[model samples]
Target chain A: GQQVMQIPQYQHVQEGEDFTTYCNSSTTLSNIQWYKQRPGGHPVFLIQLVKSGEVKKQKRLTFQFGEAKKNSSLHITATQTTDVGTYFCAGQLAGGTSYGKLTFGQGTILTVHP
Target chain B: DAGITQSPRYKITETGRQVTLMCHQTWSHSYMFWYRQDLGHGLRLIYYSAAADITDKGEVPDGYVVSRSKTENFPLTLESATRSQTSVYFCASSESGTSNYEQYFGPGTRLTVT
Candidate 1:
């Protein structure tokens, strides 16, 4: 039973402010994926980090994986109203028969105020 | 019509009644997954199917059953729905079962059990 924990259950920031959410796992993860879910919408794949100490960026957003592959962080620069939504980090466990059994974190709800 | 889609965008059923949620994808993806999202919590995997005849249980698959009769269809069945099953269910599909694959999710089905 792998567990993924997320920080900042809720966050409110100005339109131009920056936002970041951290995620950790009790056990080592094979890979980590990030998702964004808009209010009243379903989750959409954002990115995935596989290698240790990996860092990937999508436009103004950056995602990082810990050296041990047990933690990750998603950071956004100059947040906008469109960035208002819940960010989730899911971990894929190693040696599991299921290939993509994503253990999702509690998710961090982000609200951008104008 | 080209991406993943779920049926009955919203549904309300009584406790102990049977309910089924339909999921279809046009990409002929080999991996399909079901997840439930609750307030303040991230999406938790209910079940997943690797291929048409291969299925496996996930973190929260106790009360849910999933079947993959074809590469394009994956449906979830709740034999006897309960209050705890009242939540937003999402169906996601990925072209590959590999850990690096990105998942595409449906619009989601909101189920309310009274």
Candidate 2:
């Protein structure tokens, strides 16, 4: 069975500060996806990383994939109150049988204070 | 309306009772998934369907059953619920069952078993 581990189970940051969460998979992944869930809300797709060593950005947020395709990281700069939520990283194993199956990390709960 | 939706946003049932959670997507996506989210376990896959009548077990499928009679509906049933089955359930759909597809999640259903 595949597993995705996430770091910083909980984080509290002052507004305008920075935040980062890391993710690692037990097995190589075909691709990785990131999601965010607001308080009492469903998770929403944020971004996806496919190529090794790839980096993608959405506004003040940055996402990176490790060269081995087994790890990833998300960094948020100048964090705002709106960024308070749970962030999750999920990995899809590399195989034909995988078929849209995602092994999700435990998730990092982020809290931003004013 | 247009996106994925789950019925009975909140439910409370007895330990030995049976429960069913409904999931529907208007996008006509080819892939649908069911996941349970606990406090620390994050999101564990319960079952998934590639298309109508094609379903497979995921990481945590025990005590649960799923059926996909049509492309737009995937229902999950608990034959005999237990206290351990109390958690938030999310239904998601994707354009395809391929590695690169991103999932669209429904609002989620919270079930409490006493």
Candidate 3:
């Protein structure tokens, strides 16, 4: 079975600080997706990384995929209170029929203080 | 009004009782998934359906059953609930299983089994 591991189970940062969370997969992944879930809210899709050694940016956030397609990282620049939430990384196994199945990491809970 | 939705935002049931969670999507997505969100375990997949009548088990499928009678509906049933089964459940849908597509999650159902 495939597994996705994320680090920094919990993090507290002052406003305007930076944050980063790493994700690793036990096996190669066809793609990896990032999600953010606010308190008392459902998870929302952030971005997806599919290419090897890929990097994508959205406003103040940056995402990177490992060259081996087995690891990823998400970095938030100048975090704000609105950035407080749990971050999750999900990966799909490279081989066989995925059928839209994903292995999710334990998630990194982020807390931002003013 | 044209996205994914889950019924019974909150529920409480007894250990031996049966409980069902309903999910509906208006986009006619081909893939639907059920996941349980625990405190430290994050989101663990329970079951998934590629299309109507095509379902498969995920990482944590014990004591749970799923059916996809039509493209828009996927229901998860707990045959005999347990105390350990208490958690927040999320239903998500995607247009396809490919790596390029992103998932849209519903507001989630919080179930407590006593």
Candidate 4:
């Protein structure tokens, strides 16, 4: 079974500060996806990284995939109160009939103080 | 609903009772998933369906039953609910398994077993 480990189970940052969370998988992944779940809300799709050493950005958020494709990271610049939520990274196993099934990380809970 | 929608946004039940959460998606996606989210565990997949009448277990499928009788509806059931079953449940759908397409999540159903 595939597993994903995310660092910093919890993070508290001041407004305007930077924050980042990393996801590492014990086995190689075909691809990885990032999601954000606001407190008491459903998770929303943020982005997905497929190629090795890939990087994508959306406004102040940046997502990166490791060269080995077993790790990924999400960094947010100038965090704001609206950025508070639990961020999760889900990885997919390469060989399977149902390859797109995700193994999600424990997640990084972010709290921003204004 | 036009997109994806979950019924009984909140529910409370006794420990030994049985309960069901309903999910309906208008996209007619071939892939539907059920996940439970706890405080630190992030979201753990309970079950998934590739299409109607095709279902598979996920990371945390025990005590949970799922059925996809039709393309647009996927329902999750707890035969005999336990206090441990108290958590937020999310339903997601994707077009297929290869494209790394995004998952569209429902509003989530919050259940409490006492």
Which wins on DockQ, candidate 3 or candidate 4?
Answer: 3
| lDDT at position A57, candidate 2 | 96
DockQ of all candidate complexes: 0.77, 0.86, 0.87, 0.78
lDDT of 1 at B17: 96
Quote each prediction's TM-score: 0.95, 0.98, 0.98, 0.97
Off by over 4 Å in 3: B97-99
Error of 2 at A12 (Å): 0.7
Candidate 2 TM-score, C-alpha based: 0.98
In candidate 3, chain A reaches a TM of 0.99
lDDT of 2 by residue, A38-102 (tens): 99999999999999999999999999999999999999999999999999999999876766878
Itemize residue pairs with steric clashes in candidate 1.
Answer: none
Off by over 4 Å in 2: B97-99
When 1 and 2 are scored with lDDT, the better candidate is 2
10 residues in a row with least lDDT, candidate 3 chain B: B95-104
On residues B1-114, what C-alpha lDDT tens digit does candidate 1 reach at each position? 579999989999999999999999999989999999897768888999888999998878888888888999999999999999999999999877454768899999999999
- Tens digits of per-residue lDDT for model 2 on B44-85? 999999999999999999999999999999999999999999
> What's the residue-level lDDT of A85 in candidate 3?
95
Quality of candidate 2's docking, in CAPRI categories?
Answer: high
Off by over 4 Å in 4: none
Task: List model 4 lDDT by residue over A75-95, tens digit each.
Answer: 999999999999999998776
- Candidate 4, residue A29: Cα displacement in angstroms equals 0.5
Clashes of 1: 0
